[model samples]
Every structure is written in C-alpha cells, then in structure tokens.
Target: MKKQLSKIIKLILLTCLIFTSMITQPATADIASGAKIFEIHCAGCHENGGNIVRRGKTLKKKALKKYGMDSLEAISAIVTNGKNNMSAYKDRLTTEQIQDVSAYVLEQAEKDWR
Candidate 1:
C-alpha cells in the first residue's frame, strides 16, 4: 500500500508539470500573412516601422500601448474600428483576417520592437 501511494503521487506530480509547461508556452502569430496585409494596406503610410507622421502612429506594439490592450483581440478590434485618424477596416477586412493580422502584428512587433 505504501509503495502504491508513492507511485500515485509521483504520477500526479508529473502530470501537473506537463500541464504547467503547456500553458506557459508562448504562442506566436503568423508573420508572412501579417507582412502581406501591412504591405497591401498599411505600408504606404508606415514602412519598416518608420515614416508615419500623418497616419497617427505605427501599428507596432508601442503604438497599441496607449490603448492598454496588447492581446490579439484588442488589436483586432482597434484595426477594425480604426481608432482616431485611422480609417475603419470593418467593411474592408473579414473577422478572421483581422484576427490573423493582429496576431501577426503582435508577433512581429514584440520580436522587432517591444
């Protein structure tokens, strides 16, 4: 009985460790799609994270910082709504596309900027 209980305890601990690692893993977004979207839509105003004096601000992580929303969802909403001087993209882009692009933006921005 004692040996059986010890084995069970070890199994439980091992299971918990695996679960923890899976949840803590960093999930990233697609860069190629994001780059395509930026080029076709946003690059004219902001290129290589530079020359965006008129378009309000760069879509980089730092620009999104003012809204206090860093998650993929928040960025998606902002893109659809077109905050401030930015034009709304709701009619232009699909929901899934927005989400994908948002995730891509986060993935790139964090790696390249913040």
Candidate 2:
C-alpha cells in the first residue's frame, strides 16, 4: 500500500510539472504575416515605422517607449481599440492577426526599423 501511494504521488507531481511548463511557455506570434498585414494596412502612414501623420508618435523604439506603447499588449490594445487618429482594426482583422502585428511592431521597433 505504501509503495502504491508513493507511485501515485510521483505520477501526480510529474503531471503537474508538465502542465506547468506547457502553460508557462511563451506564445509565439507570426511575424511574417504581421509584416504583410502592416504593409497592407499601416504602411500608408507608418512606413518603416515612421509615423507620417504624427511624427512624434513613430513606431521606433524611443518613440514607442516615450509614448508607453512599447509592449505587445500596449500595441495590441491600440490596434484593437484605436486611439486618436489611428483607426481600430478589431472590426477588420482577427485577434491573431492583431497579436502578430503587435509582435512585429515591437520587433521592428527594437531593431530601430533597420
């Protein structure tokens, strides 16, 4: 009985470890699709991460940090809800697309848009 109980406890602990690792893994966004989406939808005013409509509000790393739009969540929220002159894409793009684009924007910003 003691051996059986120990085996069961070990199995449960191993299962919990696997479950925790799976849930804690970071989500990967589709960067290539995000680039394409940005070109089609956001390039008119934000070509190369430069905001033509609002020069100070560019997507470059510094500008994004200054405006508190540096994170994926922040960018995603703006894309989904829209702010000021920016149009909301929630009606036009799917949630996954939005997350991808947000990831792309942050990646580009980190690279200083090359």
Candidate 3:
C-alpha cells in the first residue's frame, strides 16, 4: 500500500509538470528566442537595457515612455529604421526577428532588466 501511494504521488506530480509546461511553453520559447536574438544583435549597444551611446534613449521603461517608444510597434519601427546613433536593421534582420527582439525588449523592460 505504501509503495502504491508513493507511485501515485509521483505520477500526479509528473502529470502536473507536463500540463504546466504545455501551458507555458510558448511564452518561454518566445522569451528564450528573443534573448538569443538580443544577444546576437542588440546586446552590444543595449547591454542589460542600458544604452552606451545614447544614455537618455536607454531601453528602460522610463526612457522608452519618455521617447514615446513604449509599445512593441514603436520599438520595432525604431529598430527597423534606426534613429539617431542607432543603425538600421531593416536590411539585416528579418521581420520576424525584429518582432521577436521587440517582444524581448518589452519583456525585459517590464522586469527592469533584472
């Protein structure tokens, strides 16, 4: 009886884990994918969401909001066109990649680049 109960508990835990993973997998995958994209392309200038060249235009929530760039579309436009010291990535990165990086930036901004 003890062995059966232990097995049942383990099975239930495993089932719960699988279900949780299924529910959260897409968001996790997007974040991980965006992290990779950011590392390859945006990390040099915006390391940890801090802009080296343009300090006032950092990727933080406050700076972004101040510059009217708080939304994903706004960020994507800036990334695509390149403003001020920032170079245009429209030719280099695909549309999907730009969108992914935008999502990643927004997520990091919300978390304050913890």
Candidate 4:
C-alpha cells in the first residue's frame, strides 16, 4: 500500500510539471507575414520605418508612444479604421491579417525597426 501511494504521488507531480511547462511556453508569431503585408501596404510611406509623408508619425517606438499607439490593439484599430492620411485596410485585409500585422509592428517597434 505504501509503495503504491508513493508511485501515485510521483505521477501526480510529473503531470503537474508537464502542464506547467506547457502553459509557460512562449507562442511564436508570424512576423514574416506581417512584414510582407507591411511591405505591400505601408512601405510606400514608412520605408525603413521612416515616415516621409509624416515625419513625426514614424513606426519607431518614440513616434508610436507619442501618438498613443504603443500597443497592438491601438495599432490594430488604426489599421482597421484608418486615421488622418492613412486609408482603412479593413476591407483589404482579413481580421487575422490585421492582427498579424499589428503584432509585427509592435515587435518591430520594440526592436527599433531593425
């Protein structure tokens, strides 16, 4: 009875460990797809993260933070609805593609457009 109880306890602990690892694992995003989308849609004005049309509205971290667009949701909204000089991409891109591009923009912003 004692040996059986010990085996059961070990099995429970191992199960918990496996679950914890699975939950903690980081999920990867499709940055390359986002890059392609950006190239097709945003590169004309934002080449190399440089905003020629609007110098202060570059994709760099400072510009994003200054314009209250430092998060993925904010960027996604802008992409979905469009703002000021930018045209809405809601009809052109699917919801998932918008999300992917938003994620990519945030990732690139963090990397300083490198």
| Candidate that would win on lDDT | 2
How would you encode candidate 3's per-residue C-alpha lDDT over 82-103 as one tens digit per residue? 9889999999988878888898
Model 4 per-residue lDDT tens digits across residues 1-114: 999999999999999999999986534557888899999998898888888887888989999999999987799899999999988999999887888788889898899988
Best by TM-score: 2
Estimated TM-score for each candidate? 0.61, 0.79, 0.73, 0.73
Residue 1 in model 3: shift from native, Å?
Answer: 72
What is the TM-score of candidate 3?
0.73
Q: What is the descending lDDT order? A: 2, 3, 4, 1
- RMSD to native for every prediction? 5.0, 2.8, 9.0, 5.1
In order, the Cα lDDT scores of the candidates are 0.72, 0.94, 0.89, 0.88
10 residues in a row with least lDDT, candidate 4: 23-32
Tell me which residue pairs clash in candidate 1.
Answer: none
In the range 26-102, model 2's lDDT, one tens digit per residue, is 47899999999999999999999998888899999999999899988899999999999999999999999999999
For candidate 1, the lDDT comes to 0.72
Q: Which pairs of residues collide in model 4? A: none
